[model samples]
Target: MSGVKMNNVIKQYGEIQVIHGIDLQIKDGEFCVFVGPSGCGKSTLLRMVAGLEETTSGQMTIGTRDVTTMDPSERGVAMVFQTYALYPHMTVKENMGFGLKMNGHPKSAIEAKVAEASGILKLDEYLDRKPAALSGGQRQRVSIGRAIVRGPEVFLFDEPLSNLDAELRVEMRVEIARLHKEIGATMIYVTHDQVEAMTLADKIVVLRLGRIEQVGSPLDLYRDPDNKFVAGFIGSPAMNFLDATSGEDGVTIQALKMTAPNPIGKTSKAVTAGLRPEHLEIDPAGDALRVDLVETLGGVSFAYLVSDTGEKIVIEERGDEPVSEGQRVGLKFDAKRLYLFDAETEQRLRA
Candidate 1:
């Protein structure tokens, strides 16, 4: 296994520079995930690491070897793309062992490696089946198995779960996590799905507009984001932003008619208060909020409300009786759980 490192890396397509200078590190055997919205350059950065895209400037290294200019085969990395890229005429065994065969490995050695990968991915039952006969999940597993047979030092996944169905995506996430745990290889996965990043990543690298917003453990990013963008992008239903202004004693939220203590020192600048959906509670005597809609997902519910100031907020509901649509209700904000950001800069105001 080998760690990957980039020092002020930049990528450009003639005059259009899609990737700005980026510096990052992935520890050996770490399951690192790159997550961001579409056109955020996460895939471009991943492709750069895989040697599929060239680095316009700066340095990149795999382990102790500089691979910025090296060929894809020399980078010691195996990539599993979004597509399965399986051959319809080839059986699972053949597909898995094809790479090794092309690389001129002995037939017996190829068989041994294929057997090992198949065992790891539970593809032994489907080895004799062709790609047309396998399910989407199984075909994806075959694709992953093909990468495993190469025994590369680093594994790169570019939205490998994007093609799978919801259920299959969940299953594949578990399987990939298990595979990482069992093999202990350095792996970098790229996906726009925050859930996947939160579930599978040992370290999550949140990117925005070709620049890294923040890099930390999943919970660290979720609970302690550096800015509004990071905070909003890291969580489901996202963190709610409320218009507020700094006051002498505390920050006053006009929308909720609440004042949360300013943990940071007093500031004259306008502020935006962030509250996660789970942190807000329904209170009969609190600020009145009109429910626009309610989404009940079994154990938990989400109440979409329009505050008095016309700001939209989502509150997670856990009670047996959920707040209904078009209902007027009061909301209580947990001052301790509140997040404060500078309205102009959108940067967190830390205590």
Candidate 2:
């Protein structure tokens, strides 16, 4: 396995800079995922690591070798693109062995490598099938199998499952995770999907506006986000943000108020109170809200309501007790799960 390093990397087109100076270290055999919205520079960063795009400045290394200027094929890295990229006339075996053949590897060596990768990916049954005859998941596996045959030190996946159906995507996700465990190759994946990043990564790299926002384990970022953006971006259904003003013991959120143990310092006069939907509970005898909508999802249900001050709040509830629209109800935010951030800077203010 090999690790990857990017030091003070920059990317620019003409005079406009897309990627600011960024530094990252992906450990050997670690499943590192780069996640962010479009125009966030995640793909550009990955392309730089693969040598598909030249870095405007700075150094990049794979393992102990400086590969900033090395050709993609010479860097000992393999990339699986989103589009499958398989030849229409080629069989699965041909597609998987094409790279090795081009590199002058002997026919016997190429055959052995292709057979091994096919077995690992369970593509042995489909080796004779063309791309047109395979399912989306099978096609994606072929794409990955092509990479596997290269015996690369590192694997780069560029949203390989984006085109699959929801169920197939979930299945492929598990397959990829298992492949990582079995091969133990260092992997870097890029995706805009939060759930994908949260589930697949040993470490998640969150980027925003051409710069990295934060990097940490999934739960670390979830449990303790450094800023409002990280807090809101990492969770499903997202954490709700309510405008608030800090007072003696706690902050006031319009008519609905909650108290914290310690007050935010004078440096932060105003704060935004954030509550995950799952952290907000419907309390029959608590703060009143007019239910606007309720969405049931088997084990959990989300109730959307308008607070007494007309601000929107989303609450998670359990059981079969149904909530109706336009019904006035009470809700409470779990104090322990609350997040407070500076209103101006959007940085986390208190624990």
Candidate 3:
């Protein structure tokens, strides 16, 4: 197993630079996830580490070796792509052993390695089945088994579950997490879904536009986001941001018609107040906002509310009180739970 390191890594195509200088560290045997919106260069960054994309500058190291310019095959890393990339006519066993066969390994060695990987992924029964005869999840498992046969020092997954349905995605997430633990190998996964990152990562790197916005554990980034972008990007319902102005009394929220703590200490400066859906409490006595929609998913529910200024907010409902669409309600929360960001810089106002 090996840790991966990037020192001021950069990538560009001609004159148009896509990935800015990025410095990251993925510790040995750690599950690190790179998450961001589309076109944010998460995939590009992963490819660079795989040696599929050229690094215009800076250094990349795997373990203690400088693999900055090494070929993908020589980097001691195995990649499982979004697409299954399975051979349509090959049996699962054959496909998983194909890489070793291509490398001129003995036939018996290939079969032994394939069997071991199949057992680990629980694909023993499907070993004789071709890609066409397998379900999406099974096919993906075979694809993963192919990587496992390589026994690479690091494993890389590039949105490997995007093709699966929601149920299969969840199932595969558990399988992948289990695979990481069973193998205890270094793994770097890339995804646009924050939910996957939250559930799978030991450490997460949040990217935006070609640069990293923040990097930390899932809960750290959720509870103590450094800026508005991170706060809005991490949570499922996302954080609600309302425009406001700082004053002597505090920060006055314009959309919700309320006041918040002024942690900025910059009076008269424009700011945005952030509140998470789960943290908000409904004040039925003060009808300042109107519920636009209600979504109940078994044990939890969410009330979508709209303010006079047309700003929307999602409030989580897990209590006994029932909130229906079109009902009028008010929002309240503790001052300590509120997050304030400078409107101009979009940075958190640390007190």
Best-matching candidate per TM-score: 1
Clashing pairs in 1: none
Score every model by TM-score.
0.98, 0.96, 0.97
Please give the CA lDDT of all the candidate structures: 0.93, 0.88, 0.93
Name the regions of candidate 1 deviating beyond 4 angstroms.
Answer: none
Residue 39 CA displacement from its true place in model 3, Å: 0.2
Worst 10 residues of 2 by lDDT: 259-268
Ranking by TM-score: 1, 3, 2
For candidate 1, the per-residue lDDT at 187 reads 98
What is candidate 3's lDDT per residue for 164-278, written digit by digit as tens? Answer: 9999999999999999999999999999999999999999999998899999999999999999999999998999998888877888988778887766566677888999999
Least accurate stretch of 10 residues (summed lDDT) in model 3? 260-269
Relative to the unseen true structure, what is the Cα RMSD of model 2?
1.6
Clashes of each: 0, 0, 0
Of candidate 1, the 10-residue stretch with the lowest lDDT total is 260-269
